[model samples]
Target: MIRVIVADDQPLVRSGLAMLLDAADDVEIVGEAADGQEAVTGAQQLQPDIVVMDVRMPVMDGVEATRRITADGFSRNPDAPVKVLVLTTYHVDHTVHEALRAGASGFLLKDTAPADLLAATRAVAAGDAWLQPAVARDLLAEFAARPDPRAPDAGLLARLTPREREVLVLVAQGRTNVEIAESLFVGEVTVKTHVGRIFMKLELRDRVHAVITAYEHGIVVPRKA
Candidate 1:
Protein backbone atom coordinates (compact mmCIF):
# COMPACT_ATOMS: atom_id res chain seq x y z
CA MET A 1 0.00 0.00 0.00
CA ILE A 2 1.11 3.59 -0.62
CA ARG A 3 0.89 5.42 2.66
CA VAL A 4 0.04 9.12 2.50
CA ILE A 5 -0.41 12.17 4.69
CA VAL A 6 -2.67 14.96 3.45
CA ALA A 7 -1.89 18.47 4.64
CA ASP A 8 -3.95 21.60 4.08
CA ASP A 9 -4.98 24.45 6.34
CA GLN A 10 -8.61 24.05 5.39
CA PRO A 11 -10.42 21.15 6.94
CA LEU A 12 -12.61 20.68 3.89
CA VAL A 13 -9.67 20.43 1.59
CA ARG A 14 -7.88 17.91 3.77
CA SER A 15 -11.00 15.81 4.23
CA GLY A 16 -11.86 15.91 0.55
CA LEU A 17 -8.41 14.74 -0.48
CA ALA A 18 -8.44 11.99 2.12
CA MET A 19 -11.78 10.71 0.92
CA LEU A 20 -10.72 10.63 -2.71
CA LEU A 21 -7.44 8.86 -1.99
CA ASP A 22 -9.00 6.42 0.45
CA ALA A 23 -11.20 5.03 -2.32
CA ALA A 24 -8.13 3.73 -4.11
CA ASP A 25 -7.35 0.17 -3.04
CA ASP A 26 -3.62 0.66 -3.35
CA VAL A 27 -3.60 3.96 -1.47
CA GLU A 28 -4.24 4.72 2.20
CA ILE A 29 -4.66 8.04 3.98
CA VAL A 30 -2.50 7.38 6.99
CA GLY A 31 -2.80 10.86 8.50
CA GLU A 32 -3.84 14.46 7.94
CA ALA A 33 -2.53 17.85 9.09
CA ALA A 34 -4.10 21.29 9.08
CA ASP A 35 -0.91 23.32 8.83
CA GLY A 36 2.64 23.06 7.61
CA GLN A 37 4.23 22.49 11.02
CA GLU A 38 1.75 19.76 11.73
CA ALA A 39 2.46 18.34 8.33
CA VAL A 40 6.15 18.13 9.08
CA THR A 41 5.48 16.54 12.45
CA GLY A 42 3.07 14.05 10.92
CA ALA A 43 5.57 13.08 8.26
CA GLN A 44 8.30 12.50 10.82
CA GLN A 45 6.00 10.42 12.97
CA LEU A 46 4.21 8.49 10.26
CA GLN A 47 7.01 8.03 7.75
CA PRO A 48 4.55 7.80 4.91
CA ASP A 49 5.42 6.98 1.32
CA ILE A 50 4.13 10.38 0.19
CA VAL A 51 2.78 13.64 1.56
CA VAL A 52 0.02 15.56 -0.22
CA MET A 53 0.98 19.10 0.73
CA ASP A 54 -0.69 22.43 0.23
CA VAL A 55 1.58 25.22 -0.98
CA ARG A 56 0.26 27.83 1.44
CA MET A 57 -0.48 27.18 5.08
CA PRO A 58 -0.34 28.82 8.54
CA VAL A 59 2.47 28.31 11.09
CA MET A 60 4.84 27.26 8.30
CA ASP A 61 4.49 26.59 4.63
CA GLY A 62 4.48 23.56 2.38
CA VAL A 63 7.90 24.44 0.96
CA GLU A 64 9.61 24.39 4.35
CA ALA A 65 7.71 21.31 5.47
CA THR A 66 8.68 19.53 2.30
CA ARG A 67 12.29 20.50 2.77
CA ARG A 68 12.37 19.27 6.34
CA ILE A 69 10.63 16.00 5.58
CA THR A 70 12.81 15.27 2.57
CA ALA A 71 16.03 16.55 4.08
CA ASP A 72 15.49 14.50 7.22
CA GLY A 73 14.73 11.41 5.12
CA PHE A 74 11.39 10.74 6.77
CA SER A 75 10.64 7.36 5.24
CA ARG A 76 10.66 3.68 6.09
CA ASN A 77 14.02 3.42 4.40
CA PRO A 78 16.58 6.16 4.77
CA ASP A 79 18.03 5.73 1.30
CA ALA A 80 14.59 5.95 -0.35
CA PRO A 81 13.48 9.34 0.90
CA VAL A 82 9.90 10.38 1.43
CA LYS A 83 8.16 12.08 -1.50
CA VAL A 84 6.02 15.24 -1.39
CA LEU A 85 3.32 16.19 -3.90
CA VAL A 86 2.38 19.86 -3.64
CA LEU A 87 -1.13 21.07 -4.41
CA THR A 88 -2.12 24.69 -4.77
CA THR A 89 -5.14 26.64 -5.84
CA TYR A 90 -3.06 29.30 -7.56
CA HIS A 91 -0.39 28.84 -10.22
CA VAL A 92 2.11 31.14 -8.52
CA ASP A 93 5.39 30.63 -10.37
CA HIS A 94 7.78 31.22 -7.46
CA THR A 95 5.86 28.83 -5.24
CA VAL A 96 6.18 26.13 -7.89
CA HIS A 97 9.92 26.62 -8.16
CA GLU A 98 10.36 26.73 -4.36
CA ALA A 99 8.30 23.59 -3.85
CA LEU A 100 10.37 21.65 -6.38
CA ARG A 101 13.59 23.03 -4.93
CA ALA A 102 12.44 21.93 -1.49
CA GLY A 103 12.12 18.36 -2.81
CA ALA A 104 8.50 18.08 -3.86
CA SER A 105 8.17 15.26 -6.36
CA GLY A 106 5.21 16.83 -8.15
CA PHE A 107 2.99 19.92 -8.39
CA LEU A 108 -0.72 19.88 -9.13
CA LEU A 109 -3.51 22.38 -9.12
CA LYS A 110 -6.06 21.72 -6.38
CA ASP A 111 -8.82 21.55 -8.98
CA THR A 112 -7.15 18.65 -10.78
CA ALA A 113 -9.45 15.83 -11.78
CA PRO A 114 -9.85 13.08 -9.21
CA ALA A 115 -8.36 10.47 -11.53
CA ASP A 116 -5.38 12.69 -12.32
CA LEU A 117 -4.77 13.31 -8.61
CA LEU A 118 -4.69 9.60 -7.94
CA ALA A 119 -2.35 9.00 -10.85
CA ALA A 120 -0.06 11.83 -9.74
CA THR A 121 0.11 10.57 -6.16
CA ARG A 122 0.90 7.07 -7.35
CA ALA A 123 3.57 8.34 -9.76
CA VAL A 124 5.28 10.40 -7.04
CA ALA A 125 5.14 7.50 -4.59
CA ALA A 126 6.77 5.30 -7.18
CA GLY A 127 9.75 7.66 -7.43
CA ASP A 128 8.69 9.71 -10.43
CA ALA A 129 8.09 13.44 -10.81
CA TRP A 130 4.66 14.57 -12.03
CA LEU A 131 3.96 18.05 -13.39
CA GLN A 132 0.94 18.83 -15.50
CA PRO A 133 1.90 20.01 -18.99
CA ALA A 134 0.51 23.47 -18.34
CA VAL A 135 2.42 23.69 -15.10
CA ALA A 136 5.63 22.65 -16.83
CA ARG A 137 5.15 25.26 -19.51
CA ASP A 138 4.55 27.97 -16.94
CA LEU A 139 7.56 26.88 -14.93
CA LEU A 140 9.76 27.01 -17.99
CA ALA A 141 8.51 30.51 -18.75
CA GLU A 142 9.19 31.63 -15.19
CA PHE A 143 12.69 30.21 -15.34
CA ALA A 144 13.27 31.95 -18.62
CA ALA A 145 12.11 35.24 -17.19
CA ARG A 146 14.36 34.97 -14.16
CA PRO A 147 17.15 32.51 -14.78
CA ASP A 148 18.51 30.52 -11.89
CA PRO A 149 21.40 32.30 -10.27
CA ARG A 150 23.68 29.28 -10.11
CA ALA A 151 25.70 28.83 -13.25
CA PRO A 152 25.26 25.57 -15.12
CA ASP A 153 28.12 23.18 -14.60
CA ALA A 154 29.63 22.86 -18.07
CA GLY A 155 31.26 19.54 -17.24
CA LEU A 156 27.84 17.98 -16.61
CA LEU A 157 26.68 18.68 -20.17
CA ALA A 158 30.04 17.60 -21.54
CA ARG A 159 29.59 14.23 -19.85
CA LEU A 160 26.39 13.37 -21.76
CA THR A 161 26.56 11.60 -25.14
CA PRO A 162 24.77 13.20 -28.07
CA ARG A 163 21.80 10.81 -27.78
CA GLU A 164 21.46 11.46 -24.07
CA ARG A 165 21.51 15.22 -24.67
CA GLU A 166 18.75 14.81 -27.27
CA VAL A 167 16.69 12.85 -24.79
CA LEU A 168 17.24 15.47 -22.12
CA VAL A 169 15.99 18.24 -24.40
CA LEU A 170 12.88 16.27 -25.27
CA VAL A 171 12.24 15.58 -21.61
CA ALA A 172 12.59 19.28 -20.80
CA GLN A 173 10.01 19.92 -23.48
CA GLY A 174 7.70 17.62 -21.44
CA ARG A 175 7.65 14.68 -23.84
CA THR A 176 7.06 11.31 -22.29
CA ASN A 177 9.34 8.38 -22.99
CA VAL A 178 6.84 6.89 -25.44
CA GLU A 179 6.43 10.21 -27.24
CA ILE A 180 10.17 10.71 -27.42
CA ALA A 181 10.64 7.21 -28.77
CA GLU A 182 8.02 7.80 -31.43
CA SER A 183 9.53 11.14 -32.36
CA LEU A 184 13.06 9.77 -32.51
CA PHE A 185 12.02 6.56 -34.29
CA VAL A 186 13.42 4.40 -31.51
CA GLY A 187 11.95 1.98 -28.96
CA GLU A 188 10.64 3.26 -25.65
CA VAL A 189 13.26 1.19 -23.82
CA THR A 190 16.01 3.00 -25.71
CA VAL A 191 14.55 6.32 -24.63
CA LYS A 192 14.43 5.20 -21.04
CA THR A 193 18.09 4.17 -21.26
CA HIS A 194 19.05 7.57 -22.59
CA VAL A 195 16.96 9.24 -19.91
CA GLY A 196 18.63 7.25 -17.19
CA ARG A 197 22.04 8.17 -18.53
CA ILE A 198 21.04 11.81 -18.69
CA PHE A 199 19.91 11.73 -15.05
CA MET A 200 23.12 10.04 -13.93
CA LYS A 201 25.32 12.44 -15.82
CA LEU A 202 23.44 15.56 -14.74
CA GLU A 203 22.97 14.34 -11.16
CA LEU A 204 19.25 14.98 -11.41
CA ARG A 205 16.88 13.51 -8.86
CA ASP A 206 13.94 13.14 -11.26
CA ARG A 207 12.34 14.57 -14.38
CA VAL A 208 11.53 17.87 -12.62
CA HIS A 209 15.17 18.35 -11.76
CA ALA A 210 16.12 17.35 -15.29
CA VAL A 211 13.80 20.02 -16.64
CA ILE A 212 15.34 22.64 -14.38
CA THR A 213 18.80 21.57 -15.46
CA ALA A 214 17.85 21.80 -19.11
CA TYR A 215 16.70 25.38 -18.63
CA GLU A 216 19.64 26.26 -16.41
CA HIS A 217 22.06 25.02 -19.06
CA GLY A 218 20.17 26.55 -21.99
CA ILE A 219 19.58 23.09 -23.46
CA VAL A 220 15.95 24.06 -23.92
CA VAL A 221 14.15 27.43 -23.83
CA PRO A 222 10.58 28.40 -23.32
CA ARG A 223 8.92 28.55 -26.70
CA LYS A 224 6.87 31.56 -27.85
CA ALA A 225 3.27 31.05 -26.94
Candidate 2:
Protein backbone atom coordinates (compact mmCIF):
# COMPACT_ATOMS: atom_id res chain seq x y z
CA MET A 1 0.00 0.00 0.00
CA ILE A 2 1.12 3.57 -0.64
CA ARG A 3 0.90 5.46 2.62
CA VAL A 4 0.10 9.16 2.38
CA ILE A 5 -0.23 12.28 4.52
CA VAL A 6 -2.44 15.06 3.24
CA ALA A 7 -1.65 18.61 4.38
CA ASP A 8 -3.73 21.70 3.81
CA ASP A 9 -4.82 24.58 6.04
CA GLN A 10 -8.44 24.35 4.98
CA PRO A 11 -10.46 21.61 6.55
CA LEU A 12 -12.60 21.13 3.47
CA VAL A 13 -9.58 20.74 1.26
CA ARG A 14 -8.01 18.27 3.61
CA SER A 15 -11.23 16.25 3.91
CA GLY A 16 -11.85 16.29 0.20
CA LEU A 17 -8.39 15.06 -0.65
CA ALA A 18 -8.55 12.44 2.01
CA MET A 19 -11.84 11.15 0.65
CA LEU A 20 -10.63 11.01 -2.92
CA LEU A 21 -7.40 9.23 -2.06
CA ASP A 22 -9.06 6.87 0.35
CA ALA A 23 -11.22 5.59 -2.48
CA ALA A 24 -8.15 4.11 -4.14
CA ASP A 25 -7.54 0.56 -3.06
CA ASP A 26 -3.80 0.79 -3.28
CA VAL A 27 -3.67 4.04 -1.31
CA GLU A 28 -4.27 4.77 2.35
CA ILE A 29 -4.57 8.13 4.03
CA VAL A 30 -2.38 7.50 6.99
CA GLY A 31 -2.44 11.05 8.33
CA GLU A 32 -3.75 14.55 7.75
CA ALA A 33 -2.41 17.95 8.84
CA ALA A 34 -3.75 21.50 8.91
CA ASP A 35 -0.38 23.17 8.34
CA GLY A 36 3.14 22.58 7.06
CA GLN A 37 4.66 22.06 10.47
CA GLU A 38 2.15 19.36 11.24
CA ALA A 39 2.88 17.80 7.88
CA VAL A 40 6.56 17.64 8.72
CA THR A 41 5.84 16.15 12.09
CA GLY A 42 3.51 13.58 10.57
CA ALA A 43 6.08 12.63 8.00
CA GLN A 44 8.72 12.08 10.63
CA GLN A 45 6.38 10.08 12.80
CA LEU A 46 4.49 8.13 10.16
CA GLN A 47 7.19 7.79 7.53
CA PRO A 48 4.61 7.68 4.77
CA ASP A 49 5.44 6.90 1.15
CA ILE A 50 4.14 10.24 -0.09
CA VAL A 51 2.95 13.61 1.24
CA VAL A 52 0.25 15.58 -0.58
CA MET A 53 1.35 19.08 0.39
CA ASP A 54 -0.30 22.42 -0.15
CA VAL A 55 2.12 25.13 -1.28
CA ARG A 56 0.76 27.74 1.09
CA MET A 57 0.11 26.98 4.73
CA PRO A 58 -0.20 28.76 8.06
CA VAL A 59 3.06 27.57 9.62
CA MET A 60 6.44 26.91 8.02
CA ASP A 61 4.88 26.57 4.49
CA GLY A 62 5.20 23.63 2.16
CA VAL A 63 8.66 24.51 0.84
CA GLU A 64 10.32 24.35 4.24
CA ALA A 65 8.27 21.30 5.22
CA THR A 66 9.38 19.57 2.07
CA ARG A 67 12.99 20.43 2.76
CA ARG A 68 12.78 19.13 6.29
CA ILE A 69 10.91 15.97 5.35
CA THR A 70 13.16 15.09 2.45
CA ALA A 71 16.39 16.17 4.04
CA ASP A 72 18.91 13.38 4.60
CA GLY A 73 18.59 11.57 7.97
CA PHE A 74 15.07 12.92 8.66
CA SER A 75 13.30 9.98 7.11
CA ARG A 76 13.73 6.65 8.88
CA ASN A 77 12.97 4.77 5.68
CA PRO A 78 16.08 5.64 3.73
CA ASP A 79 15.49 2.74 1.34
CA ALA A 80 12.13 4.20 0.35
CA PRO A 81 12.57 7.93 0.62
CA VAL A 82 9.40 9.85 1.31
CA LYS A 83 8.35 11.84 -1.73
CA VAL A 84 6.40 15.14 -1.76
CA LEU A 85 3.77 16.20 -4.32
CA VAL A 86 2.95 19.88 -3.94
CA LEU A 87 -0.42 21.36 -4.88
CA THR A 88 -0.77 25.00 -5.71
CA THR A 89 -3.51 27.42 -6.64
CA TYR A 90 -1.23 29.55 -8.79
CA HIS A 91 0.72 28.50 -11.84
CA VAL A 92 4.38 29.20 -12.52
CA ASP A 93 4.95 30.85 -9.16
CA HIS A 94 8.10 31.21 -7.09
CA THR A 95 6.65 28.97 -4.38
CA VAL A 96 6.38 26.10 -6.83
CA HIS A 97 9.97 26.60 -7.87
CA GLU A 98 11.04 26.73 -4.23
CA ALA A 99 9.10 23.55 -3.50
CA LEU A 100 10.86 21.75 -6.33
CA ARG A 101 14.26 22.94 -5.18
CA ALA A 102 13.29 21.93 -1.66
CA GLY A 103 12.92 18.29 -2.79
CA ALA A 104 9.31 18.06 -3.94
CA SER A 105 8.93 15.29 -6.49
CA GLY A 106 6.04 16.85 -8.40
CA PHE A 107 3.80 19.93 -8.70
CA LEU A 108 0.13 20.05 -9.60
CA LEU A 109 -2.60 22.63 -9.66
CA LYS A 110 -5.23 22.09 -6.99
CA ASP A 111 -7.91 22.04 -9.65
CA THR A 112 -6.25 19.21 -11.56
CA ALA A 113 -8.57 16.38 -12.50
CA PRO A 114 -9.05 13.84 -9.75
CA ALA A 115 -7.65 11.06 -11.89
CA ASP A 116 -4.55 13.06 -12.79
CA LEU A 117 -3.94 14.03 -9.18
CA LEU A 118 -4.18 10.38 -8.16
CA ALA A 119 -1.86 9.41 -10.98
CA ALA A 120 0.66 12.07 -9.95
CA THR A 121 0.67 10.85 -6.36
CA ARG A 122 1.20 7.27 -7.49
CA ALA A 123 3.88 8.27 -9.97
CA VAL A 124 5.85 10.20 -7.35
CA ALA A 125 5.43 7.40 -4.85
CA ALA A 126 6.85 5.02 -7.46
CA GLY A 127 10.02 7.10 -7.67
CA ASP A 128 9.12 9.03 -10.82
CA ALA A 129 8.67 12.80 -11.26
CA TRP A 130 5.52 14.55 -12.47
CA LEU A 131 4.74 18.11 -13.58
CA GLN A 132 1.94 19.66 -15.53
CA PRO A 133 3.43 20.50 -18.92
CA ALA A 134 2.18 24.07 -19.15
CA VAL A 135 3.23 24.85 -15.60
CA ALA A 136 6.66 23.36 -16.21
CA ARG A 137 7.22 25.40 -19.35
CA ASP A 138 6.18 28.65 -17.71
CA LEU A 139 8.18 27.87 -14.57
CA LEU A 140 11.33 27.16 -16.58
CA ALA A 141 10.83 30.32 -18.57
CA GLU A 142 10.60 32.31 -15.38
CA PHE A 143 13.74 30.67 -14.00
CA ALA A 144 15.67 31.26 -17.21
CA ALA A 145 14.68 34.92 -17.13
CA ARG A 146 16.13 35.44 -13.68
CA PRO A 147 19.10 37.82 -13.38
CA ASP A 148 22.44 36.05 -13.23
CA PRO A 149 21.22 32.49 -12.96
CA ARG A 150 24.13 30.18 -12.22
CA ALA A 151 26.33 29.46 -15.20
CA PRO A 152 26.12 26.03 -16.77
CA ASP A 153 28.52 23.59 -15.19
CA ALA A 154 30.31 22.31 -18.26
CA GLY A 155 32.56 20.08 -16.22
CA LEU A 156 29.64 18.35 -14.55
CA LEU A 157 27.85 17.97 -17.88
CA ALA A 158 30.94 16.48 -19.46
CA ARG A 159 30.34 13.39 -17.37
CA LEU A 160 27.39 12.35 -19.51
CA THR A 161 27.83 10.28 -22.66
CA PRO A 162 26.42 11.56 -25.94
CA ARG A 163 23.29 9.37 -25.63
CA GLU A 164 22.69 10.51 -22.08
CA ARG A 165 23.01 14.06 -23.27
CA GLU A 166 20.28 13.40 -25.85
CA VAL A 167 18.07 11.94 -23.17
CA LEU A 168 18.59 14.94 -20.94
CA VAL A 169 17.60 17.29 -23.72
CA LEU A 170 14.46 15.29 -24.42
CA VAL A 171 13.65 15.29 -20.73
CA ALA A 172 14.07 19.05 -20.56
CA GLN A 173 11.71 19.30 -23.51
CA GLY A 174 9.05 17.63 -21.29
CA ARG A 175 8.96 14.34 -23.12
CA THR A 176 8.03 11.31 -21.06
CA ASN A 177 10.29 8.27 -21.08
CA VAL A 178 7.82 6.39 -23.29
CA GLU A 179 7.64 9.26 -25.77
CA ILE A 180 11.42 9.57 -25.79
CA ALA A 181 11.77 5.82 -26.43
CA GLU A 182 9.38 5.94 -29.38
CA SER A 183 10.98 9.06 -30.75
CA LEU A 184 14.47 7.58 -30.56
CA PHE A 185 13.29 4.19 -31.91
CA VAL A 186 14.53 2.49 -28.76
CA GLY A 187 12.74 0.32 -26.21
CA GLU A 188 11.23 1.96 -23.17
CA VAL A 189 13.65 0.09 -20.90
CA THR A 190 16.54 1.55 -22.86
CA VAL A 191 15.13 5.01 -22.37
CA LYS A 192 14.78 4.36 -18.66
CA THR A 193 18.41 3.27 -18.46
CA HIS A 194 19.52 6.38 -20.32
CA VAL A 195 17.45 8.57 -17.98
CA GLY A 196 18.90 6.89 -14.91
CA ARG A 197 22.38 7.39 -16.25
CA ILE A 198 21.65 11.01 -17.01
CA PHE A 199 20.49 11.59 -13.45
CA MET A 200 23.49 9.81 -11.99
CA LYS A 201 26.03 11.50 -14.25
CA LEU A 202 24.57 14.95 -13.68
CA GLU A 203 24.00 14.40 -9.95
CA LEU A 204 20.36 15.46 -10.23
CA ARG A 205 18.09 14.81 -7.28
CA ASP A 206 15.11 14.11 -9.54
CA ARG A 207 13.53 14.96 -12.88
CA VAL A 208 12.53 18.47 -11.74
CA HIS A 209 16.14 19.28 -10.90
CA ALA A 210 17.23 17.64 -14.12
CA VAL A 211 14.96 19.95 -16.06
CA ILE A 212 16.21 22.95 -14.05
CA THR A 213 19.84 21.99 -14.70
CA ALA A 214 19.12 21.52 -18.39
CA TYR A 215 17.62 25.00 -18.58
CA GLU A 216 20.41 26.54 -16.49
CA HIS A 217 23.05 24.84 -18.66
CA GLY A 218 21.47 25.91 -21.97
CA ILE A 219 21.02 22.29 -23.02
CA VAL A 220 17.41 23.15 -23.82
CA VAL A 221 16.30 26.75 -23.89
CA PRO A 222 12.69 27.55 -23.12
CA ARG A 223 10.86 28.54 -26.26
CA LYS A 224 9.32 31.99 -26.24
CA ALA A 225 5.56 31.60 -26.14
Top candidate (lDDT): 2
Candidate 1 per-residue lDDT over residues 1-225, each given as its tens digit? 999999999998899999999999999999999999999899888888899999899999999998888785466686667789999887665786888877788899998899999999988876667887666777777766666655348887899988888888888877888899999999988998898888778767678778877877688987766
Cα RMSD (angstroms) for every candidate in the order listed: 2.2, 2.0
Identify the runs in model 1 with alpha carbons over 4 angstroms from their true place. 72-79, 150-152, 185-187
Give all candidates' CA lDDT scores.
Answer: 0.84, 0.86
> Per-candidate TM vs. native?
0.89, 0.91
Give candidate 2 regions above 4 Å deviation.
147-152
Steric clash pairs (candidate 1): none
Question: Tens-digit lDDT track for model 2 on 1-225?
Answer: 999999999999999999999999999999999999999999999999999999899978999999999899987867788889999998757899888878899899998899998999888887777987757778887656662244337897898999899999898887888999999999999999998887777767677778878887778888877
- The lDDT of model 2 is 0.86
Evaluated at residue 180, the lDDT of candidate 2 is 96
Candidate 1 residue-pair clash tally: 0
